[model samples]
Target chain A: MLAAARQLLVREGPGAITHQRVAQEAGVGRATAYRHWPQPDQLLLDAMGGADLPLFKDPSAPIRTWLHRQLRQMADELEVRAVAAMALTLAHSALWDPAIAHRQAESVRTIIERILVATRSAVASGELETEISAVDVAAMLVGPIVYRTTMQQGTVADDLIDRLLDSIGTWRD
Target chain B: MLAAARQLLVREGPGAITHQRVAQEAGVGRATAYRHWPQPDQLLLDAMGGADLPLFKDPSAPIRTWLHRQLRQMADELEVRAVAAMALTLAHSALWDPAIAHRQAESVRTIIERILVATRSAVASGELETEISAVDVAAMLVGPIVYRTTMQQGTVADDLIDRLLDSIGTWRD
Candidate 1:
């Protein structure tokens, strides 16, 4: 059922994610689909929630290297149809309702938390320096990738990662 | 009709902006609305296009001060329900269709061009220095505000403007 919902989202937009359509796509009865997920938002959220992309591998690497790899991974994933669809669904729904906003924040917070781990380790090892909170740092680094790819409808050039790292007050030995 | 569409967008999200509803809101005939905007996307686009927020007032200020003011203006405007609604509508539509993507890029480009005007003047006047293009600079400065407000459902702090300016290689005596 979740698979059908995701497929519909990728192929069409959120408007297409109806219980009837999803059940048909899943080869199940509409009643079964509705019984399991009565709310459309719940169905859409569950589908998107289950479709998590793999996070950056090896958070133990040098901070700059790890950031570059992680951002690149994010850039690549945004190009995927399902990922972009899910992101747009969450973004569009989030603004209209506070409940959706909380859910969207939860998803974004998890991603930023992973970044905090890398930055904390880097700061501890004297490999990076910054006064801003980890959230702000994540916003500075990851925000551009989101802006360039999702907002501007453009790809993240490899050099962009370098420029971003340079601009963010990283330290050298 | 555009006013009606804008009202619907702000109050009820994109789902509420239909010919029948907008015509009713505008106190016009449904046929008139349909004649003017046969397609829903066209109506949404026209309504959003007409709802442009005022850009930064003075572009002649020093680059850092100019960026700070401009970003603060943007942060404040995004808090406006209509502005955020239009932005989310464009963003959600852009991903599903390339035609919508082109339209979205045009709107975003105009805003970026204004930023470029400031940065170009600053570069010529020696008030600021950067090797990156104006687009990347705008992304670095403005992107965090968007990420903070729309993506994270948070407000932009004044210090964030200072941090962004400091990080972006601005020069000072």
Candidate 2:
């Protein structure tokens, strides 16, 4: 069932995952699919649990390089038709509800923590302006990408990150 | 029909809006509603035209004051159950789709232009950091807020903006 769910999510996008479709796609009985996973979101969360994100690596690389690489990975995720499709459905469905918001905050905080860890070194090395929390910096980095992603897909140009770093006097090879 | 649609959006959310509901709510026949709006999106768009947003104001006020005031207004809007309700539905339904994304880009660009205009003035007055375009400054101000808004519902804390301002050396009395 899980494999079927992952296959469906990756192959067709989130909107295509009805119980009947999953059953047919997985070659299982309809009742079996519903019994195992009642909704697409539950199945999606299960699938996302094991999917890999591009890990930040090469500490020897310049901070700007690392940042841009990380951003590019996010852009790739956003541009994926299936991921974007499912994400949009989830956003509309239960993501913003109070119950889900409370449950997800813990995970979101963890994601921010990972970003803060990377940014702490940049601040120490004078690559980032001091005084602003690493959290805000993460927000600054991710915000425009998301804004462009939802407001205008694929509108983030190549020069934006470099320009922002330059403005902060942090741009360097 | 528009009034009915508006009532449905505010009362039951965008998902609750259908030709049947609007017709019943407006005391009109179904054909009349369909004739007026071939699609529900047209009605929804019309209903959203007059939403009162917290606009940037007080030209003489310090830039930080103006920003904080503007942010407070956004927080207010986010907290409004109905607006948030409809926004989430719209986000899922069409906002992330390719067609809506292309159309929304120009308006989003205009919003950015307004922020850039404000940031340009602040740069001249030594209120904002130099060398960065107003566009980057605007991104800094907006990214975190939107991140918090979408990722965690209404998690923009009262002091978070101030901390960001202070960190960026934009904090002023």
Candidate 3:
């Protein structure tokens, strides 16, 4: 049922993930699909949350390097034409759905926390010489990538990643 | 006429700046408004392009400081419920309009050029130590503000601005 819903979502976006369509896609009965997932939005969110996505790999790398990789990975996903469109739709819709809004905020907070952790490590290692807070560094690292992806409609390039990394790495105390 | 159009735009958003309303607001006849500016979009663009608006302020401070101030100004504007809605509507509409798209791109480029000029002066004065390209630095500076405004719907506070300046300033070498 989940697989059917995922196929429907990937093909027709969040709007087309109905129980009937999922059952048709999965070659199962509509009742079966409905029994498994009650709401289409809930099904879509579950599928997205259940995906076996990549984890943060280099947790100990320099803050800049780690951030660049994370951002590039995120941008790569966001740059996918269908995914990008769906994500934007979801973001806009999140304004009305308290559950979705909370989930979205939590997702963003998780990413920020990861970067904060990395920054703390870097600071402990004496690699990043600065008086800046970890939270501020995390925000700066995530800000540009989110800006480019959401507004510019494309993936941030490797050169941009390098520039961002270099900019953060060289911060003076 | 342009002043009245801008008042409607900044106060009520893009949808409210119709020929009839603009004419009414300007105390001019509907026929005269249409005869002078056939397309409402063009009128809004013209108003945005006008010199009297506070959107384009000349900064006398150093590049980083000036950039921060400019971003803060934009943040303040974004905090305004009406102007933020209008600016966002305009940005999304630019995706479909070639002329508006060009203007939006140019607006970003112009802001970047201002930062580049400042960075060049800093390099010449031995204040900056790095050889980072001005364009890249400009992106780093502007990207966060744009992201905060568009995605987070939040203001780029003084602390974030200061952290951005500190991070980028250290990239001199």
Top model by TM-score, which number?
Answer: 1
Q: Rank the candidates by DockQ, best first.
A: 1, 2, 3
For each candidate, what's the DockQ?
0.43, 0.30, 0.29
Q: Tell me how far the alpha carbon of residue A95 in candidate 1 is from the true structure, in angstroms, after superposition.
A: 3.7
The whole-model C-alpha lDDT of candidate 1 against the native structure comes to 0.74
- Candidate 3, residue B123: the lDDT equals 65
Interface RMSD of 2: 3.6
lDDT of 2 by residue, A1-173 (tens): 66776677556544455678878888999999878877655666556544332334333336777777777666566665555555555555554465545445554565567666666667667666555454555565666666556644544556766543443334433
| Best-matching candidate per DockQ | 1
User: Which tens-of-lDDT digit does each residue in A55-108 have in candidate 1?
Assistant: 643487577787788788777766555555667778887766787777778778
DockQ of 3: 0.29
Model 1 residue A50 CA deviation (Å) reads 3.0
Model 1 chain B poorest ten-residue lDDT run: B49-58
TM-score list, all predictions: 0.72, 0.60, 0.65
Model 1's CAPRI class? acceptable
Residue B125 error, candidate 1, Å: 0.6
lDDT tens digits, residues B1-173, model 1? 88888877666645566789999999999999999987665786776655543464348667677778778877876655555665677788776678777777876787678777877778788888877776777678877878877776667788877888776666764
